[model samples]
Target chain A: MASPVFRGKAITYGDDVNTDVIIPARYCTSFRAEELALHCMEDLDPEFLKKRRPGDLIVAGNNFGCGSSRENAPLAIMGAGIACVIAKSFARIFYRNSINIGLPILESPEAAQAIAEGHEIEVDLGAGRIRNLTTGASFTAHPFPEGIRAIMAAGGMVGFVRARLGVDAPAQPGRERKRSQG
Target chain B: MGMTIAEKILAAHAGVPVVRPGELYFAGLDLVMGTDVTTALSAEVFAQMGAQRVFDPDKVALVNDHFVPAKDIAAATLAQTMRRFAERYGIRHYYELGSSGICHTLVPDEGLVSPGDLVVGADSHTCTYGAVGAFATGIGSTDMAAAWALGESWFRVPETFRVIFRGRLPEWVGGKDLILRVVGDLGEDGARYKALEFVGDTIETLPMAGRFTVCNMAIEAGAKTGIIAADDATREYLKGRATRHGVYHRPDPDARYARTLEYDVSGLEPMVACPYSPANVKPISQVEALPIDQVVLGSCTNGRVEDFRIAATILKSRGVHPKLRLIAIPGSQAVFRQLLYEGIVAVLAEAGATISPPTCGPCIGGHMGVLGPGERGLFTTNRNFKGRNGHPTSEVYLSGPAVAAATAATGKITDPRTLMG
Candidate 1:
């Protein structure tokens, strides 16, 4: 799988956007990714689901995904057809959870400050480059380690581990296996 | 080179002579816990990963606490999934709705964790086990699935933040106040990816329940885990409940620290974390008389017997305000039983507080006592993030049991001292 080069319109938010606002605990009863996506960011912005376009990028402030260790927060973002998230900083658990689920999130302290809502941005995961098309400004984020990049390339930890154990085929970027139990 | 307790525990589990911060290793876990809300998903992931069996059944515990007694069809189905997974895997420590309490409390009460052990759980409050000197932290369901599959999980050794408490705590000021002060000073993400080592005279004298309360909120400050060196109090608390006894480790006096904070608790006042964030803390004196619609007095953080005892004392002759709704939930069945045996339950019931089973009711907004739009709640549960209780517009203030009881009596956020006086 090749590293991703994403270009999308950015939906921005401020600091400390917690999980409760991302996906409230009430909707967490469902384990299905698609089901969770329906309520993603519903409380914080009731129009988030309706307004979000496929491959849209979320640009947010520091400590994004701060409360609760719910993996559904990232899953919902991925299921909402979001391509990636760029934040000033992320909570520790959410950072790991996002990577484990193959949602590429970059941290650029300058990206949120410079980018405006509905700005079109380009991201190159391999090069760690984020460019704001609307402003013609670019910023660099810390690149993921080769191992993690490989896992993300594999669509997530499950696919990564399956490929490592020879139980599944090598992953193709952006292609995820259906998460149904046989 | 000297190491902190967290590093030492990680080293032992990783089968390495020594380890340092920033080093990643897969360490064997002594215990891995999950709740009904988490385990069902983890079980699905575990099956999806094609793991034939759990790495070690004895070291794993699955509890039904988050949606205990099954609040709805979805929650009941989730619980059923976990139950079947436990039965199929022959998991030795599965606790059903009536039998189990909160995972964080039940694991230790049942002797499932001990000092110097590496522990992980799906619930973020799993760090509560660190009160026993165990290296415990929370993980996501995917990581939990990996741990269940391999009996080991990867970790990045965290920098240690040394917090020393001096002087004696003032009356009515307990772990909740101390931890709130820490979060207030450090901010929510101040200790991100770091381990907290709580020490000094005040911590040494604190009861195990109080220690648990402090450790339970470590995650609120973004700490990977919070630890206190096991002492006589810890030993006594774990006396018959510990599955194993072993040498407990403490930080070397000269161990390097990322930062050291000293807190004098003699003058500390009861505190509250206001709406929107746990780090937005202020002394109860500052927010006194803020009208409240509800009061929640139980959770893993302050849901122990001692907390209820404090609440009962405050509510003894005083009745809850007619406009208020008070909900008291015990952390575990064990704590619930003590409430009954001591008649604390009766006291709360007579005072107009409704007693619920030992589930994480309304704390995570799952069920029971959920708030509506424009409502405000004062609770003992950790995390007051926006929309945390139930409705997005609803607000929550976090405080200790004493303040909760006082607030219930007056239907407002009142300082416990006002009632005590």
Candidate 2:
């Protein structure tokens, strides 16, 4: 099972970190997960690679991912192995995208201020807990709704659907289901 | 206890208890559409999830747009991903690049959508479909993957804001202007978590293209979706569409709105969205006459037959200023072919304009018409955000196609009203 708690350092940004800046338009056509990871945060800090740790958390102001509804932006972050993000608020698309990929995202300006770059921290989803390992300061997060948490715990929506419907993984090849009625 | 258009649509589709604004509800999404850029990723996510079959392949629309001619190998790969996925899933509504227009424009034209249905697309501009009375908005690829696998998603029903555009609009004033004015009045986040319903006589008189323009920019104002009640134009637009598609309308005589706000259309003027933000709007008259190096006159916004006709009228017999690199890109093949048949293309060329293939170029700073360093251009595209048209230093001012043509002819920020009379 994936860890319910995340431990990491911190990276901060201001409001409205649009999709264009997160992954830029030039990299939009590329489908390889590796190439996108290289471009993540390149717009804001070209040398982010040298500064980042594997489990570092990103802290941002309101409306992060406020521009295009591109999934690559969040996918790049998750691919790069960043553990979580705490922001004042999030663009609706980004919030949904982060959850869909099983990336933990918390909304708390207080915790955002408490953590600093290179500072160690821990986050627990089920318990709605966040702890700064460096300073020993702990905070709380709003746990996901029961249904959404179940889906997240299953690793994503697809896993949840497979489990609930009792369908085999990858449903049988050459088996196309008819359109379901609304 | 007011209900939003999103809530109403969900309630109607769910066929259960009433829903209020801000309340979260999970419902089966009626449709999910995507262009080349989106479908490719969605297919990948589906594969990662190990889902062999989509919840409803028939309801999934795959349109190969964004990079229409397959500009490079990467774009071609994305398009190919969509093709293979459509073939594997037995998707019926796959639109090839040449056959399709913009994804948002093509959805309604193909008759796959209807009123009161919840549509989630991977493109931000997908909200444009709300003009037809559907509760359409954008989502990301991952959320779209959920919709693909389960045929459903959750939404926080938004509050409703009734915007009444009354009286007659001035000649140069149009849909682009109306939407800009609405943004000005409401501020960028004023309508956050709210649905906008355009009502009153002025909106009733506007054409379908005009209504689409208004709905397209609803996202800029932070609204869930901008909508208008279905009327004669809606009926005519849907008349020739296939009968299998669902048709829905607003509640009769006693319809209710949460918060009603009115605007005097007659007082509004042509508007421009300054570089760096869509919310920074100013009257076109206030924009100084600065020389431009480029002029782009097409996009999902202001890229229709009527838009081209008005532009052609302005460009008739007048050559584009030698200093300006004028470009016109039709929104769709139909618009492109029709402009050629109607000789609008000849007029545009005679006026010294370069025509490009029908695709969104330079609107989001994608390939075709990137600006060089220190370049300044007047564009007919929506949103003139900083670096939107290539160089972060390049300045782009948003305007209607008519103003774009006029500016191209004069080589500066000139208004269409000056040339007309």
Please give, for residues B114-207, the per-residue lDDT of candidate 2 as tens digits.
Answer: 7666788888777888878888888887677767887887777777788889999888678988888887677555576578888889889998
Give a tens-digit lDDT track for model 1, residues B281-353. Answer: 9998899989999999999999999999999999999989999999999999998998999999999999999
RMSD of each: 4.4, 4.2
Residues A30-124, model 2: lDDT tens digits = 75666888878775667676777888888787667666788888888876778888877677777777777777888776777677767788888
Name the regions of candidate 2 deviating beyond 4 angstroms.
A1-3, A109-122, A130-139, A168-182, B1-4, B185-188, B242-247, B251-260
Name the TM-score of candidate 1.
0.96
In model 1, how large is the Cα lDDT of residue B14?
94
Give all TM-scores, in the order shown. 0.96, 0.90
Residue pairs that clash (backbone atoms under 3 angstroms), model 2: B276-B386
Backbone clash tally (model 2): 1
Give each prediction's DockQ, rounded to 2 decimals. Answer: 0.52, 0.43
